[model samples]
Target chain A: MQFTSEQRLDDGVLEREFTLDGIPGVLWTPGSGSAPAPLILIGLPPLGLRKVYARVAARARYYAAEHGFAAATIELPGSGERPRWEAAEQARADLRRVMAAGEPVTDEIVDALVLPLVERAVPECQAALDALLSLPGIGGPVGYEGGVISIGVRLAAVEPRIAAAGLFAGSFVPAAIVEEARRVTVPLQVLLQWDDEANDRQAALNLFDAFGSAEKTLHANMGGHTGVPRFELEAGARFFARHLR
Target chain B: MQFTSEQRLDDGVLEREFTLDGIPGVLWTPGSGSAPAPLILIGLPPLGLRKVYARVAARARYYAAEHGFAAATIELPGSGERPRWEAAEQARADLRRVMAAGEPVTDEIVDALVLPLVERAVPECQAALDALLSLPGIGGPVGYEGGVISIGVRLAAVEPRIAAAGLFAGSFVPAAIVEEARRVTVPLQVLLQWDDEANDRQAALNLFDAFGSAEKTLHANMGGHTGVPRFELEAGARFFARHLR
Candidate 1:
């Protein structure tokens, strides 16, 4: 999606939607600013930019307004205007079956469902970055945060434009992602819920450990998958403010 | 299982089988040695110590014979003669389903399957440590290796009995295991196969990164899950010798 249209949201941020070759995305920019601003790219939660992740999704715009940063929320491949892939359906079915049977899942199944999306997402994010940074009021060395940490992991490894990343340790991570994380020299902040049933605790730790970053922190608290404390979110805001600001 | 039977194996190692309350296990000791030897506790692979893991199971005995160490191998809670828990059956079914459907599995399923075994195995390992240390040719500050790194991770955290550990980053690791690894200050060596499909790469990195051991080393190689090279095994043996011998 080329930078398509812009609308003023009630919150007063300039919300612009884009369709990168068909994939839909939204970029939030601080109102009344044509001056170049720092860019922050956000990957949405597992449910996409839905009710479950509205607050998280708003983080980009929040940074745009309060921190004088420009932020973008790109849709994952097979999401929004992009045609959905069969893998999502298959993954959903598999989850239903496994949950019903109450079985242990091998990583093989997970890779099949997620690896393609991540593979597709990485390039799309790069394209999104290319589009966003070229727009008015945008600059280089981007910041990234949110659920699709796989994209963040790969971007941090391969994309020099990403200055810093905050990864949500709440999804199925493959070995390739961890290996890629070893190449991530950018500063990182990983948020983990100790009792997150869906997230692999070891995997989260492994990704954090593999980071080549000289400066990194793991914000782990004892809670369910989405039960991150408000204080932690504020602390994360401070982290972004320190680095991205 | 409590220590019940002790027999001499053909290779001049005293073999003993135990059933701790309900769990079953075997211990091997250097033959004709009343001289207290440093202990090496072996954690079994996901595959129970059946014909599939016979060679792997002989590790403790080999360490005992070749290194003059008293070694013990404890069965996981549901292995050997112990009644398989419903959770284990559910986990197995789930793994099969996910493998068949070729879906990426959530760590929730892995946790559901492995967490109970790990929880039960940790205390049993502590008890095994207590019982084995009371026997002749047994000593404290032991070396631990192999799959149930969960037990190794836990024992390394709470049970000061473990002096060193050789962690095989080849199985499903829970979040608690990573948290426990953070508390593991004992000298440690971790083995990883770079392309292990079943193992989550990020989790392995997380667990390795979380280890608090100042003297820790990650012996990672390019191979599949079980394709560990002979030289690597020798290197691991050398690691154990340096720490336990």
Candidate 2:
């Protein structure tokens, strides 16, 4: 399937749109250069619609513009410009339909659906990655970033493409998956919500053990799972720039 | 500051510790070979003496283990096992102190703090970018993955990071300081409760817009800011795997 590209601006930043292998997506090209740059693919929560992800995409574009990099955000196969799922059940049913269509429920489907929907929308997350990789300047290798603020930590384990990742207010996947993900050959940055309710310190400890690497940094910020302290962004941005850049 | 390192295991994985300069920051290691891997730094939200961020750190470790990557989750300066904040107000004060102490707040700080906090936390969100320069295994340039999801499009202009991040739930900080935080160029991610009484999707959009590279991921798991979802662990695991790995 052929995809098209369009240009638009949110808050005075330039953004473009396109489809990837039939998936509707958007590209936020930093008017900088055309070299293959780092790409960040965002995952949506189960109840979240394409609009929410679009905000994230727009944010990515802004970041790219400022950082001299190219950025793109894509909607799921059946999301964004695609059909909508009115409720949890409807979303699940739609997922099932996608699976039934012989779509090869890869990591994207699992992230966008099963994990977040059933577990926390981890499985279906790959949809975003797939879309991001399909872009003109994005298909080489990729960096990974996310946090429990959206899905959780476990889903990150399943993605094999992430060379370096930064997680905020994040948690670990099941022990098995945690162990599996730890086997990935990438640099990782994790951000935790010190007062988070969903996952506690003990759980975070368990996750750390599962990772088993020495090149890791741990930072604590203020806020609950829903209330991370304000200072975290500075630390996170520094960390991302230092590592990912 | 001299940093130290130690190792431990939680759920059947190896975890490491890094002392900020030399304190009690913990790190999780993924992978087995005796090779130097890239480093990743994880950030956690603060709630003082709470184990919230700790759990997130552990999850990062688990992701490292599964992905065979070397990683770490660190505590913020004066957080976790280090000098701790006396209260949220104190924490905020500490932030100001850090800003003041740091090499004068430059355009970066202005981009990270002053702008987003003041202008948008309540309304209108700006677009940002998500770019990955590295990842595990897929060693190459990174690219875009998928479509965008714009939740609370109206709130796209609001800078939820430093201002009224969880404002919808009646969680408000001094609007003035929030405005100050808007200028900071710190990367932030805001998690909004779908069912929170104070949730204003429009405000969230504004928050997104103002926060620079902010991204919002919505979940319909049914709960308040402090409540855990039915599949919290399962979902969290998947989230980490997909994005972090």
Candidate 3:
């Protein structure tokens, strides 16, 4: 891991930009000279780091400032400045075409779009975890926070370092990913927007049910997509505190 | 309202047993003397107060000692040493018979069992609220927590003092009560036990969907009806603190 730039926020959080195996990412650590703060690995949607940076940074800062945790996120493959894959682009085009035609999005289209992404993203996240946990002041057990539900499911299922997960509920999950969800035994907190037009609520609920975790909670709130209430951020922090601390 | 007995808990919560217009109830207030603390009117299941007193009083003491909120609950009509009505008894018998025979519980049976209870309970609860709030140290914007969800829906719908509610999701809600739920505009937090064998999960979800409150949240946890995690008690306290304080 090679750090490209560094800056300190007013709240005493140290923000560092880094690249591991040519994949760009950012890490935030608490400032209190606490020997090693527990880490939270945030997951971003396919939206690039630059587009989601401000929002994700605010959450990272909250964790650092108020909750005393280190937080980090890496760009998903084929997003941000990373080169796009041909098959992924084709899948996106198909998805767009189906939605534009006002036809039902078939399972094939969803699988084509999400499965490959989850396949590539999960390994990259694990690699990033390896790099982050190796840092001097960042420690585990780590937590995984909101992003694409499929990727979060995969990571929580396979990654032993991740003791818990707080997932943002979304649709387009492939059947394979739902099956993978059954392997995730870590405690989970899932946030769902009740009226998210871009998502299917029942599918989200079903995915929540499929998790193998004995301790899982689904917090469904009234709103469209992008309307998760601010209070949930603190709730997520407390949840991680319970497990990670 | 007549005070039957009063005692100070070990945590400095003042617990008082009372009866209003011949109906029995209990109230707990913070001993801090921070005059006029906000209140939470706990709703009890119709199982009678003695049966549920220890559980509910623990919750009340939690509110008073930890959150600086007064809490109260009155026995439901035809329950807890109160006079039993034959109609409600018959409905209960019918309900048990159907469940024993593995027959689906029809809406008629549900309405018969719950509607009259709600009709009698809501008013008695309101009268209890009137007496409790009239006391010097307990104040409003009140919250209603748990118990029979239909009674909560009606109280939150028509009771102006009830600013928010935390409902324990249960079945047996009549369609009329479901419509009444749409009239409840207060912020709500509905707790659901996902694998509760006695309650219909889909019905709970649908009722959560029907609430008119723009600020409703559904917190679905894994477990059976009696298996709500202990952490949720604190979560419910924090929720009421957000709205009531």
Candidate 4:
């Protein structure tokens, strides 16, 4: 990991920008120089880091300033400054066409849109995890927080370092990912927007049901897609505090 | 309300056994002289107070000692040492018969089992609230937690003092009560036992969906009936703290 830029946030969190294997990412650590603090990997949707930077930074800062946990996130393969691939671009176009016509998003379209991203993103996150944990102050017993639900599911399923996951069930999940969720045994806290227009409620519920974790919890709040209440941020912090700490 | 017994728990929570009109109840308050603390009405299942005293006391004490909130509960009309009615007995028999025969618990049976209790219990709980809140140390902006969900839905709908409710969706819900849930606009945190043997999962999900509160949240945990994790008590206290405080 190579440091590119650095700034100290107002809340006393140390925000550092870095790149690992050509993938750009940011990391936040508590200001108090708490050595060996638990790490939380902030998963990003394909929306790119710059677009969601403010919201994502707020969450990372909350974890660092309020809970003394380190948090990091990397750009997805086909997003932001990363070079776009034909398959990913084609999938996005297909998704838009189906939605514009008000036709149902078929499983085929969903699989095409999400599967490849999951295939590539999970390893990048794991690689980022390897790099983040190797830093001077950040420590093990990591957590994964909201981004794309399928990527979170796949990472939590395969990554032993992820002691807990706080997932946002606000995206389209492929059927294969739903089945893969059964392999995840870490403690899980899933956030679901009850009236989310962009997501299928039953599919989210089914994914929650499919989790193999003995200590999984579903926190379904009443809202549209982007309307998760602010209090849930604290609730998610407490969930992580219980497991990651 | 007449005090029958008073005891200070080890953690300095004051537990008082009281009788209001002919109904027996218990109240717990923080040990220190903090007047007018927020109150939580502990809704009890039809099981007699004596039968669930240890568990009930633990919850009440948790609220009083941990959150400095006054907590109270009263025996249902046909429960504990109270007089029993033939209809309630018949409903109990019907419920047992259906369960033993592996038959579905129809809405008819659910109404028979719960509606009368709700009718009688809501008024009794309201009266308890009236008497409990009238006391010097207990205050308003009350929260209702657990017990029969239909009674909770009814009370939350009709009672103005209840600012929030933490409902356990473990009991059979009547169709009318499901409709009544739409009238409850208070912030709600509902608890669902995912694999509960006696509770219908779909019905619980539907009841959660039917609630009209704009800020409602559902916390579904992986457990059988009676297997709610101990940590949720603290979570419920935090929920009450958010609204009641």
Candidate 5:
């Protein structure tokens, strides 16, 4: 409810940057809201919610404004405005040592090191949803959206409130998510860049197959990381409109 | 190669146990060697070259005996007869800490911690090949085979000395292996139990797709990890026969 600043993007999307209940976030609502709008909860891209994801945020805004929805991006726990967890630093150090020795990043190391931070992140996402949904002019059904896509995967699996999901397959999936995917029955739209150099294409495909959703579609294009085609993004926005609108 | 014990497994397969060049191994050659025959380098199942993997070892022996090939199993650098790598334990402990905190195992963790151990394992495999090829009765083309499966994945990617590989898709894949898989042009037969609970099904399928080989066949059956039927094993043996014989 309390925004530190409010600005109008060139395209007329209303952007309000806020530190709601100690969680930092940016909310994009229509310049002229006439009724409660469907909400799109955007996860941080791999580069965090910074300049790198500006186009992403814009896309979310453009889609929402065009489709009569609201899009919001929050700082997950241990990221953005929040302080980094000590364990994350330790995990990074552990990773560096193993990489120096030319070892593969194994699951156990992921479970121990990176999992904790993301697990904590899940709750933070829930909190962001709570805060965003309660805003004066923000409303209607909510859909989980965006990349670093595993968090979206986790949210869709556990949060029954998520009416739909549009996932970007650009992150490593933990084994737990494979199990989680089996429990996710929500309608989903998973987009993948077929040849992302930094991504394990197999893992992405595996997570997509694990979804228990009968109404899931995988949209894949041959591109590297940061090379997701615009057509796919439109397809995803169209999907959310069908489900969430 | 010096033997410590020899046994006949009721099927005319001669099994010889030995500690050659500080590596513990079991060598199985058919009771009849009419001419110089092929050698199959069998990797260990998730269990070391221990009692649990005995049946697996036996299957290799039985196949080798029936098909007029020589099969041998060797303990990897960190399992069975070899001293454990100190770094692996530290990595495991690090993984435990993260998992205890309910973290999702991410790819970076695998790259840092597990890669070194598996990287070390690759050379040990080469060493085993060098030793196996040097034996009096062992001869002709060599096929690298085994599971938990990434070891086989890793070996197939790098060891051009291997004429053929029968990889079991029953383990998590590090991202590096996806890159490595591209380098594996060896004629390959990859086996998978389609419903393996402990295995990441997506990762398995992805690695299979990543292989650059034109002669690769995916032998997937509808079953759990331990439920791969006897017929599939035979099919794998048949593949080796076609490629390595």
Candidate 6:
């Protein structure tokens, strides 16, 4: 999963691509840094392409460059430029293909689809984790953080290698899954929004309680389920710096 | 003010009454500790009835007793069983009279008239604060914490005797007011919820950047509009215990 710092595109956005355990991913990496730094993976749920994710990805690239970290915003399987759903069954089968290929898909999908279909995709998520870990400079100890949903957090938590993990505006999975996720020993940060419609305050509270870590930090900010505002970035950055290292 | 343990109700479902500076209020304390606590001030905006206030008050009482803190649920001037309003202007007059009298009215009156007339009853809010601080154990160092809507926090902050103050989920106030509030040197904890609709997260961030106190601790939670969720009580309790004392 070695992400190369390549030149900006015609639109003046930096771009790069890499292959993780044979799964190729195009990365938008900022070029201002030379050292190997922390990497961020951008994922969107099964919804249509959202420009917000791109904007956030761009901001992440900027932050990574400014702070001297290697950042990669990748389009997940069946997302962004690779949308492959026409019928529901086709989408499920497509996801199964990705899972069979050993890409990392979150349990959210596994729980949503039939057992046979999920069984096929389980290895994909593992492979994705492997691909993510295989990226140059991403090895050793790594931290994963996300806010769109609980998918990313769940994915990161199951991987024993993620040293630290954080979730902002995350939804809660089934109680059993949450219980399993709580077993993750890494330092965990859960950020919740008060007025979020998709995942309301109660969901956040339940997730926080489920974590069962006395050291787990629960931050309540003013955003919906999207992302954090810019000014608040410093606090989040400080938290990440303080704990991730 | 010194709040005696006797003044505190039992953990199970219960009801009690209080007269703060002659303002009478019935506290409804619930038995189960599952519900989230509400800071039910009877005389605040969105006026309702005495029974409503009483129920909310009881809930607050129960919440405080169960959670080991105090709950202040008040009654407005004209909403509940106290009286009825002939018109908006009459309601205004009634509010003035209530504030001037400094007597506790039923939750009905407080909700219907008192809260709606807050801006005109600025002096009343101040007087209430004074009376509140005059209570047995409330004396020493009064601090305020709030978000974008900071009338309550501002009142608490400007008081010279307040030991410390913090604002979370807050919006920008007038410079003079902020300057005056900043003069109070106490440990401050500002929790900003980024991406809020009413008060932009960037604005809160900038305010935090310009605010006073080297002891200031800024945190970003994932929420909007309404303040942090109840689960944050863990952080809030720890913070207030450390600073308010």
Taking chain A by itself, what TM-score does each prediction score? 0.89, 0.64, 0.98, 0.98, 0.92, 0.68
- Candidate that scores best on lDDT: 3
TM-score of chain A of 2: 0.64
User: Each predicted complex: what DockQ?
Assistant: 0.02, 0.02, 0.92, 0.91, 0.02, 0.07
* Model 5, backbone clash pairs (residues 3+ apart or across chains), number: 20
**Across residues A1-245, which tens digit of lDDT does each residue of candidate 3 receive?**
99999999899999999999999999999888657889999999988999999999999999999999999999999999999899999999999998999999999999999999999999999999999999998888999998888999999988899999999999999999999999999999999999998899889999999999999999999778999999999899999999999
Evaluate fnat for each of the predicted models and list the values in order: 0.00, 0.00, 0.97, 0.97, 0.00, 0.10
Number of clashes recorded per candidate: 21, 227, 0, 0, 20, 54
After superposing candidate 1 on the true structure, give the runs of residues whose Cα lies further than 4 Å from its correct spot. Answer: A1-5, A50-53, B1-245
CA lDDT, candidate 5, residue A20:
64
The whole-model C-alpha lDDT of candidate 5 against the native structure comes to: 0.74
Report the error of model 2 at residue A73, Å. 3.2
Query: How would you encode candidate 6's per-residue C-alpha lDDT over A26-112 as one tens digit per residue?
Result: 454445444455555444444433544566565566546555444444444444555353544564676678769987556655455
Per-residue accuracy of model 2 over B119-208 as CA lDDT, tens digit each: 321221121111111323222111111001121212323323222121121123333433443553432334444345544443443443
Name the regions of candidate 4 deviating beyond 4 angstroms: none
- In the range A57-78, model 5's lDDT, one tens digit per residue, is 7777887567767888877666
lDDT over C-alpha atoms for residue A102 of model 2: 62
Pick the winner on lDDT between candidates 5 and 6.
5
lDDT of each: 0.74, 0.43, 0.93, 0.92, 0.74, 0.49
Candidate scoring better on DockQ of 1 and 4: 4
Error of 4 at A131 (Å): 1.1
Q: What interface RMSD does each of the candidate structures achieve?
A: 11.5, 12.5, 0.7, 0.7, 9.3, 8.9
Better of 5 and 6 by DockQ: 6
Candidate 2, position B78, lDDT: 41
lDDT of 1 at A133: 82
